[model samples]
Target: MIPGYPKETFFVPDGIYLLSHSVGCLPVSTEKHLSDSFFRPWANSGGHAWTNWLDNINAFTQALAQLFNSNAQNFCPQVNLSSALTKILFSLPTPTHRNKVVFSARDFPSIGTVLQKYCKTLELEPVMIPQDRNLADPQTWSDFLDEEVSIALITHVVSNTGQKLPIRDIVQLCRDRTITSIVDIAQSAGIIPVDLSHWQADFVIGSCVKWLCGGPGAGYLWVSDNNIHECQPDDIGWFSHKDPMSLTMNNFEYAPDARRFTGGTPSVIPFTLATESIKLMHSAGIEHIHSHNKKLLSRLASQLNVNSPCQPNERGGTFVVSFSNNQKALQTLTSAGVHCDLRSEGLRLSPHLYNSASDIDTLAELINPLLGKRR
Candidate 1:
């Protein structure tokens, strides 16, 4: 059992919850925290509540800062990852000599969709590294960062396969080539250790819905100090102004930091809820959580027909167990009160701090018969 992480801390369901990769279980403190931080102030003071609500937003950034080991000023609260990417894509100046945008086909579908939709309008060439190639190899990424590549979108962890990319190496490669690197930490943020300052990527984006135990709509964007000055975000509003309170007519100046990416009136509730979860994770300690997850993954790997990378360092928290016919097994697991997800690759099972060894054993018992002999 992992110390300092009691299962009672979160709202565990009647059955096992192995879907932390999709959406994390809600923390027990979420409701009370939201009521105290958000609802009460709005009900009591109305417009005057902006002061407290804004403070909550700052608190949210502070929580992320603590998690990522970066300054709170670097983060801009976004509605979701796709929206954040859209703003960044629109903000960057159209490349003159460099026109290629590089990404992997194994990346989340939404990222590819966003890139495809904007590449034509931005006059950029979309170069996708096919799935057949070994994505884990740094050489594969290095080969793609040619002279014409202006931006490279690197996924810290492949969502479907649970393959952890060598982000530090990839980011450094992009830096050396003068390519703007955007690291997507949606799958790695809460489960793996992420240091924004250490990455030194041009931009980083993620959401709190998964693994964070923070509900949806709480996505974020972090810009490196070296790159913030160069961004000119087209998606701007009153909040994007250096002084949002200064009601000067027709004179709009971008905020000197990452806040320039925050468009219009910011959504307060999501950040408020996310702040509680982020702080909770910070208090529990990322290293401890990571260690616990690895132990559980090892147990699962030994018992299941695992398809993800064998080394703990080479994969994220989730494990993908391959099966010839997954539909029947999926139904049986679902009926037996065992929760996990099925993807094109295989059955994806992601355990969290709340889960126990027995849960893993139970999962294996239910699915082992269906999997037949272990290869």
Candidate 2:
């Protein structure tokens, strides 16, 4: 592997932390920005500090826009992907014929939970595509779409198995069937190229707490150029009004772009915290980080005992390694200061740019003896 990034760049855990798919390691600059940009302003300026916070909000949106090769106007901040998806679900008209929302049962449970409410209240159908298909192939989804499907919620990278659905093809198919495609980019946001504006999918949700290293409380929603103008989400607050400052009790209008999706007062601290992490990501280009992490996963896989694991290119930031006694195995890794999480498939390992080959090799050495045998 290339000379890896400095560990000093992050406030890493005591052991080898491999849980970027869950919550990313803290970046060193987080402290400085939180103080200088957020705490400092509020402490010094009292109630009038909102002007500075608003600027941070704009900056945060702009920073995220750079990742997807879009502008600030294309994105809006939300509390989380669930809320972002909820706004969209409430916004879209309940179709007369095409009322099914297609998604995989194995996708994130929270998303399914959100969709289920729509199914109950809005008379939408839940079309859970069978999980029996080849775990690594997007072609399995080719037949899942039809005119009856109104919205397709696709997980860009499956949380458990690190499998990536062919989003581009899926979006294209949605277009053919006239279905709205809403993508969840939680596990792949910073590590992989989402390029939401390029794909022109109906909507996408990304969080700053995971791979983006921005911590929690900052969620992103990106509306495609094709759907931005006409999108009128039912979730409304005066902040998202076409003109927030100009208010009319009789007449209310939503913002022209992604801003229409955002409602209510936001926690402004996330913007300040995320700025530093985004800067670090830009400094270490995402493509380069992806290439390095992929090679590391392939290297780790070469040291594992498994059958036909998805290739590096086929997956995103996580790789699940199975064990007969995963609990004991987890305890062992934790004891050795190697951090990972257990999921449906196996124990998940997610490395970031800050993780080096030596770290993976060390983790593998700790993990090898725990394989197959429960004791």
What is the C-alpha lDDT profile of model 2 across 122-153, one tens digit per residue?
87789897777653465666677777888888
Could you give candidate 1's per-residue lDDT for residues 34-56 as a string of tens digits?
Answer: 99999999999999999999999
TM-score of 1: 0.97
The local distance difference test score of model 2 is 0.82
- Stretches of candidate 1 exceeding 4 Å from the true structure: 309-311, 373-375
TM-score of each: 0.97, 0.95
Candidate 1 lDDT (Cα, 0 to 1) = 0.89
Residue-level error in angstroms, candidate 1, position 39 = 1.0
Identify the candidate with maximal lDDT.
1
